[model samples]
Target: MCSCILLAALKNADEMLKDIISAVDTSGDGKIQYEEFRVFVEAAERQLLQLFRSIDRDKDGRLNKEELQAAFRRAGLSVPKRRLSGFFDEIDLNHDGFITFDEWRDFLLFMPTNHNGSPLEAAFSFYSSIVTVNPEGDSLVSDETLEGLGYFLAGAVSGGVSRTATAPLDRLKVYLLVNTKTSSNVAIAAAKQGRPLVALRNAGGPIVDAIVSLWKAGGLRTFFAGKLLLGWSRVLSGTDSHAGNGLNVVKIMPESAIRFGSYEASKRFLAAYEGHNDPTQISTVSKFIAGGIGGMTAQFCVYPIDTLKFRLQCETVKGGPQGNALLLRTARKMWADGGLRAAYRGLGLGLVGMFPYSAIDIGTFELLKKSYTRAVARYYGIHEDDAQLSNVATAVLGATSGALGATIVYPLNVLRTRLQTQGTAMHPPTYTGIVDVATRTVRNEGVRGLYKGLTPNLLKVAPALSITWVCYENMKSLLKL
Candidate 1:
């Protein structure tokens, strides 16, 4: 297993070098002259400068042994102080006890070609090189380094962007979700408010009436009523899933990172355990199974934050001051009610939903992407893997998978939200368990009740997921991820 992963990593490294060469060989000469090499190095120098500044957290012009050790730790590696000191001694060519920008740049530029060792050592060396590049230094930026930075930034920003952009739809979904029992009454009340739009209610079904009522009662702003509350609640949790609809791209960013990372890690470990090093011989189901496991792993890490965010969205507020503190108050009330357990209500159901949701979402996306890539490759006469799908294909496929996965197991989501918000000061505990929630929802509001807020949910999720995939893919291409 270890040998297999090592071989894979080495193969990846070789491909990476090829990509770097292609990117730097601007003249199409097949061979890079000294001048071409200088241009590539110069471009890399910019990233090295950023890296230097990062390591020099104190804004100092030099990096000490301590700083180098800290950088190693930042790159997900742990190195002994003694080893780092020896490494620094070699890097500090002037015997100056500290590494200057020039020395740092020279070390990276003159990196040893025979540094490859065991996979673990190679991984360690790779990450150390990555985190050591600071803005204050004069190191060169490799295409790979730039690509990595791009993925990190893209994942972080895309989540918040998708969540915040669809905030209005999410707010509507939550409103309908918590008020399903009283949705009709609320629409009637809105009609009684003498808004001219009330006439539309008579022409439509209950869902349409509710929407019209909400519009008449509050106009455009009503759609984004508690955005602040939702954002703050999610932010404070330091986890993702603050979108009020449980689909936060930001949180999913880390979730994705974890999912993919864990999948690879698990694959390597499993192959090692089974004594199978041949990569091509792996089963196709491995990807789907790995994806499902990865999703569950991510869900476990962020489910509590998700629960809190859901409860806050499902809060039954009635004409009180809507301030930022409401989130804190709600959190405190949950703490007072059942301690930590209250915040984790419905976690079981969430995990159950997550398993299949993650499996289908990731598997379907991969299958579609590959199929699209293959078709495009055939049309364009290119390698299948090298084929590029248009933005429309990426968006449509992403939206379809998201909508399908969410719809397939939507009842679990609805039940989870209800369980979290139930028994709160505002919304009393009605259902006893998952079964109870399901039974009561069906008994009280008919089968359709289990799908409350689904309209706005699909509206919000389809585009949000689409945006996430589009942004992620585009960013990956831009960074060459």
Candidate 2:
């Protein structure tokens, strides 16, 4: 009798809750889309869940401190100080030390905790909410698209690094792009163990075979065969690029009295004021964003040059320039060998590569520069954000940090290149389709087969990334982008 009574009450409560949710769902489409769902309910649920294990307080969508504290209070449980502080910090969810309704909403939807549980489950649940055009549910993205995106990011990083670092990076990428499986990380690991010789690559292969081996063996931090030369080149490139852009930007301005940073400040101030936002610190952010834009443009616009370079480099290992005779001869040979389309074989990979690589590299550099600037300012008790020297210093710091990000994310480049440029060389009896090429490579070579040439790529990454960031940062500072 007692069990039956409890079951009846639970059923009633569930029906009532469903009725309320359905009422708010309003569209009566029988499914609550993530964007269309009641915003408050989502927020409330997340907060309540994060707060306590049992009760669904506020019933918004998430668990918050309020919901947690309330549940504890109702249960007469004591809350520890340490737990309370963390809850306070996250209550706003915006990293802004204050809780807003929108932040609350995001917490409900995005917080790792929450219903259906598991981030993967939540993601699929949200995905089901997106409006799709497929009437019969046949339209879907394939693994190929995801793989393509990965390769694209990789290509972007590799290509971007090339523009930033120049010739040595060219040599480095060839080594790294060999085949991803050769991670005899005796090089990277050997550094901490005091045996540098273990990291060296073998000789008698290509133009820069020995250098390529050390790069693969050592990875990024220790892979600097021409470390000093790379650094000097980076500095020179940055200085020249920045100085040139800066001079140009100033030349067009009302510059009888205007100066470098001053012109930049004027443009930023106008935009912020026009948009009715704070402009003081924003001037610093503009250049970083602009540099990112520039990186993407340069990468895509002259990417054919990059494609040509990669093909040239690969053929060098296979036969050397003697096979094509010279740059002009090689260009003619490549076109003749594969026709027009073969010359642009890896474009999709390049496109995908640019977005993530540039975004990560530029974003990280900006963040680091801001951190360093603040640290230095606080150390010196200097509070002026618009100070000329401080801004320039921040730019430099950002450039260096951006380079490191590029290095870390460099392997994707090797993967994309292998996937795009390898296989059916546009000749007869070769499966020329991207999907067909990828499938054959995996089938015959195994999964590791796809990751060829990753080591030398990793080694080249450090300097290549370093130079890329420096050039970007310096250009932004100069161009006031």
Per-prediction count of colliding residue pairs?
20, 37
Model 2 residue 234 CA deviation in Å: 23
On TM-score, the candidate that comes out on top is: 1
Error of 1 at 24 (Å): 34
Taking the tens digit of each residue's C-alpha lDDT, what string does model 1 give over 1-481?
2222322334234544555568668898889889997887886566566677777767789988767666655554444343455557756878878888887666554232245443224434644543343433445565334434554566655555666677777867766665545435444565777764764555335556556755654455445443433444554564322233233443545655565455444554555555663321334466566557767887777676666666665553444323345556667777876887877788899889887887777667777887788788999897554477788988899899888888888888888888888865445656678998888788888877878778889998899878877877776565434
Identify the runs in model 2 with alpha carbons over 4 angstroms from their true place: 1-166, 178-293, 317-324, 337-340, 384-412, 423-455, 465-481
Q: Give the poorly placed runs of model 1, Cα more than 4 Å off.
A: 1-153, 180-204, 208-222, 225-284, 316-318
RMSD per candidate (Å) reads: 15.3, 20.3
Q: Put down candidate 2 lDDT per residue, 78-154, tens digits, no spaces.
A: 33333343444543545654444454344334323334543323422232322121333344453223323333333
Q: Model 1, 343: alpha-carbon shift in Å? A: 1.1
Q: After superposition, how far is residue 121 of candidate 2 from its true place, in Å?
A: 53
